[model samples]
Target chain A: MTEQQTGDVPSARPYYQPPSLTGRPQPANLADILERVLDKGIIIAGDIRVNLLDIELLTIKLRLLVVSVDKAEEMGIDWWKHDPMLTVRERGLDEENRELRERLAQLEGTPDDEEGGQDEGDGSARGRQSAGSRSRGDA
Target chain B: MSDMPPAPTSADGPEPSVPVSDTATNSATNPATDTVTDSSTGQGSEQGTGRYLYAVCRRLPPGALQGVHGLSGEPLELVEHGDLVAVVSTVPLASFGEDALRRNLEDLSWLESVVRGHDDVVQAVAAHGPVAPMRLATICFDDDAVRARLRQWAVDLGYVLDRVTGSAEWSVKLLELAPQAEALEEAEAPASGAEYLRRRKAAVEQRAASSASAADVADDIHATLACRAKASRQLPPQDPRLSGLSGTMVLNAAYLVPDVDAAEFTAALDELRGRYPSLLIDARGPWPPYSFAMLGQP
Candidate 1:
């Protein structure tokens, strides 16, 4: 099995290239193209006035936005300022975690089993609210 | 095996049995003619037909797109305005109509085919010379509207054409793999619940600091890339569902580099790869400057 896998790796790639880059639509990794057109913000001002008697042109947001584009970067509501890569939801989660961490630190300062239990329970509840144990990788 | 004669019924959606009816932007001048579809209840009627603008280029050869087709198999043609030309093709009102669009756009498969068709046409135009690709589904009432819109945005379009004259776009994705945790594993578990929580807190802090370093590495990568390219734009990290890759994406960036400097860019990328072997640096490009085309747009 190991030998076959190794044989497939080097031989599979260069022998048959990724198709002619010019004019050919490679279907496997089209998400790149979709992201370019969708998220890259193309502005089309007017001219498409086909009457919409029923439905409005609706764009569904794939993920929940903790903060909008207006204040996503500014106002520092973004918890993941330490890393610009994190999404709004991920940053929001991190922000909550950071607060909890600080609170946990404070709780540490003053010995209180009851409050600590309460915080632990809260963290567990939040964990449940998020997908699985730690969806930090996803968020 | 790909990108030739797209599935005809792909983006058209289930063909609307009702006769097409909608108002084009140029409803004021040319009233509805019975030849085209215009059977609305009580709306401004301009036979729901329009030219889908694909891209704009300068002085392209006549047969540049000898055998190319637009979204739903309309033969590609050019509408010339002075030396500027807008690559376009006819789109049926019934399908491209606004209500239809609202429905079609939501269908990922339909949207994908349309976007693919649009990109195919733009890529065909870009092959001949520098082309400024328009937004997907940029519609105009007719050849006149296409010319008018091109004329109106001539200066801005000219700027875009010039900006991307000999440049191409490259995508660079940085994915951060989560670090594995190794506990002390002394005998059994912690004694009390608070003790367990305390240990968990320590682990979380360690992970945070580790990820902080990952963030710095990502910044360094972006900075190095930006310095190499003519221009760089930071796109939002894609959802793993969309990206189809493991690990949290640290950076999603597109860089516009001169056609001549592409080799150097790749070499720099390779060096960075050597620097951070653990981090996945997925790079692909020579794409027609989609990220850099909005040169003069506010």
Candidate 2:
């Protein structure tokens, strides 16, 4: 098993050159091009008048297509996490965790067993709601 | 048909004369014509050619668009009204007429090719001098109608050209970092129901606080960059899928910076990147000023 895995690494190396290594202008991504040409620019009425609302809806569809296709390809690879430029420092996480714990303690006070059960239900429900709303804003 | 008189030929004679002779011959052969016929709806009746306007330039350096092709792979030509020159190419009315355009714009692949082709010509003209790009699929019946639009919108076109002459557009987007997986595992398992609730509540509050701070950082970055640019506009954040990156986009903006100030604008960006190491500051530019070329009216 170790030998097979080791052999696979050499084969994959040729196919996966990072874009920055090429030292060329990365072709503008589809989303960037679509947003500029469709959503921006001077709008002079022409002989062929395309409905503005139709263009807006088409842009929305293209955005969704770009997101879903790219997202599926990125699912198992987690490529961005490995990018050196994107690697965030770990120092802030520890400090933030400490602050959060202290605030949580202050909010809960001395908890009883019965109240703890009720608080858990409410907390989890609120967490779900916040997550739902955040995703809604992105859409 | 004789009433329209040979669509005012340009001073240079040869180039504008091609369209002049073509329209004259067209008017003579295709005599199913009337003075009051609506050009937009008369697409099916004539089955003639239409001019696809790419961009209008202040003055194109001689032969700037030498080998560049337009949307239909047709050789590009210049339609000069006065000092203002319109970059155009002949497209068959069959594919580019009003009805055909309505159907074609809905197809994704067709739209992509046309958009790319339009940008290619705009970029070619922009390389030489100031260019005000037309909206996608702005076609006219013939050279006469093309000249008519230039005559009418001369002032606004001049204003757009003046505003974008020496500058280009730059895009800057800031994305917040998603929490690392190991960080979530750092906290030990909860001892009781109360502990679980405490952790959950803390997680929620932490998320809200961080997003708020990220928004502030985005605003600060925009303000700093805007000071270096001549003009700036904040566009709505793009979807993560389209951007091909994860994490919420906090700032999606376009800045119109003079050519001389480009270095200073980028330097400011580098400084901001260092200040907010947690953010992904994606900056790309010197694009044709698509966001800033709007005439006051549609």
Candidate 3:
């Protein structure tokens, strides 16, 4: 038996891992397990003779459909790259920036140029001064 | 039909009235009747009765699985029609019934356990013969309800079983890339821009060549292994994140090999590993044809 087959030799920790982006209790071997779970499988649902629990309360239906994640990725849903947990992750700096933009927009209705000429001149002058400072700092 | 409890009888005869367990006290009135009231009237107290779902299989071995219980304490019973057997066990209606599933399906742990358990029973039946696993949390009201399903889906379920019979599933994963000294050359700062460009070009070409060689190795490995198997399909590379695996996944393929050649199939994978030092080929299997079996297939 080779070292690989035995799986005994110490190896470096894996970089990419499974079990959802967020740490949750999921099948350790997710890819293999999911191959079976997320396929065109069987579904069973029946009539309820009782009228006690609410429609939202008594009926629990199982919907199983199979689509490969690779297919989903091929569709260019690139959000998984940025957010592996998808919608489940804690909001970070990107969300903060988005919130700030939204708040700014809500407070100040869309900005129309009020002092357009003066704004342009001041912006260019500030840019030149900042460029000079940046070059000096780099040097 | 009038909503009344069926009078207590011990024969295999159909009753027009709703069937209720004898245990329901007058306070509870009739448990089966109470189940319907819970559904329509939106009242609580229909707490404990759950539908016992079973495997949806055609021509399942009769009397094969007896005295089996669901993960919960509900007694397992066979709901059959013609050749199909639904190995079912009752569960708490609040949980296994339709409404609770929609609410709890989003819970990852609950979903995983239920899916795993469903897979486990399917696997057991599949081991004996072609078995069509039910979707996660398929709840049926009673044996008659299960038989109705079998009759309704007999053709689809039969098609699924035919595709999987005389086949087994094997998983082949490519080994991770072992970093080489050439990577270090690229990492080190180049002495000049021209030299830097040259190094970068070489690095790109090297990577391309490496990938090409890995593909070649995978092809060679599959060719040799496929010779000993019935059919082979190369699935797309899996995300390391989804697989919890180390390194890149170069090849994720499932092969359906005849049971007789299973040993030879494994040996072929081992041989490929020995022959190719540039590639890592890992194989595991003889599992139920999970990847290949599908209902309503062409």
Candidate 4:
């Protein structure tokens, strides 16, 4: 162990070494990994340890909070943007938007089937709640 | 091993053994102070002895840790008790003193920074060799206090080091999402109440099956990787908020793999990913052996 910031040496002491040595290499087993993840590992609790609360609440408190983004939007709750790391399923929307724009551009070339294509496109748009439809509709 | 009869108390200081103060902070009050007074008659007189605390262990090679400052920029000291070494620094009695710690520990940020700093140091030490990290918020009032603890927990500490000797931790997460498009399609499909009920039941059964499958896969992943590593241990699943991770965490498990088979464990995870598409498996690590330092010798 290096004692940083202390150039002043204490009284000359005998070099010490612990009798217990643990540097031997071993196989990576389930006991080791499970212990690593669940039992032994660095536990960092910050100003607000939000991440650790989920399991504690669900298991010990027996409380479940399932707030849908759609419902929250209706209630004027803006938790979606609070932490981008916790949000999922947004990629599907982006993929949908690209497909819709591509279809619209393809439809732009045909004049005779304008009304029919528009209706079909509308049906497809209603059928899919993907990002593509949302983006095209907003546009 | 013969107890070296409390290393002849050096003439420089009383009870100068490093172990006394190494873990003095573990008690509710200073161990030395506690032993001096009992509440039988409400006598609170103390023996006026200070303490030293062993926070985190980060192996700073022989010379890498020469200038690192502790919690308050105090000079840090190293107390080597065999192969395992403890990095210690003196904390003012006010911060760690019996009355003050109880009063101030509730301030979450202060406690967090101290714990994190402790962990950072431990990680550094673990990088070099197997480190038996002390629990969170362990302190000692004196060198004698530390040695008393060392004497008390020698066997426990040895066990902890043996379990983590050559292992590294890895994290794997599983997430599942019910696609909006699929839900919309089902809603739009022309069907009777009976058909709708059947569909709902099927969806429930599918969810159950998926959940069971995820568990099996997690177990399999653990088994496959365990074969490559020396030892492994499991941790409770964490919440998304605590983990700072993306997606609903279906399976959040960490594995301790040997340094020699680290690549093999990762490759197994990749193969597991390809084998299961419905459930997303994101793997990270080869991290320091943090999880292996369970309750040491005491």
The candidate maximizing lDDT is 2
Candidate 4 lDDT, A78-103, residue by residue in tens = 33434323333332233323343334
Candidates 3 and 4 compared by TM-score, better number: 3
Ranking by TM-score: 2, 1, 3, 4
Cα lDDT of candidate 2 equals 0.65
Clashes of each: 0, 1, 30, 73
Highest DockQ among the candidates is held by which one?
2
Write model 4 residue lDDT over B1-298, tens digit each, in one string: 1111112222333233332223233322223333222222111222222333433342336544544545554445555444444555555444654455554554545655565555555555566677665544455544444555555556666666676667766656665553432353346564653344334434434544555555677777667766766656554444333333333445655567777777777777667767776656656665566655566223
Quote the TM-score that chain A achieves in each candidate. Answer: 0.25, 0.37, 0.17, 0.18
Candidate 1 docking classification: incorrect
Where is model 4 more than 4 Å wrong at Cα? A1-139, B1-61, B72-75, B92-108, B178-206, B295-298
Better of 3 and 4 by DockQ: 3
DockQ numbers for every candidate? 0.16, 0.23, 0.14, 0.04
Q: Mind giving the per-residue lDDT tens digits that candidate 3 earns over B37-151?
A: 3333222323445444535555445444443335453334445566666666555657755567555565656756766666666666666776666655665444445566677
Query: Candidate 2, residue A78: CA error in Å?
Result: 26
B-chain TM-score of model 1: 0.78
- Tell me the lDDT of model 2 at B88: 78
CAPRI rating of model 4: incorrect
Q: Candidate 3 local accuracy as lDDT?
A: 0.49
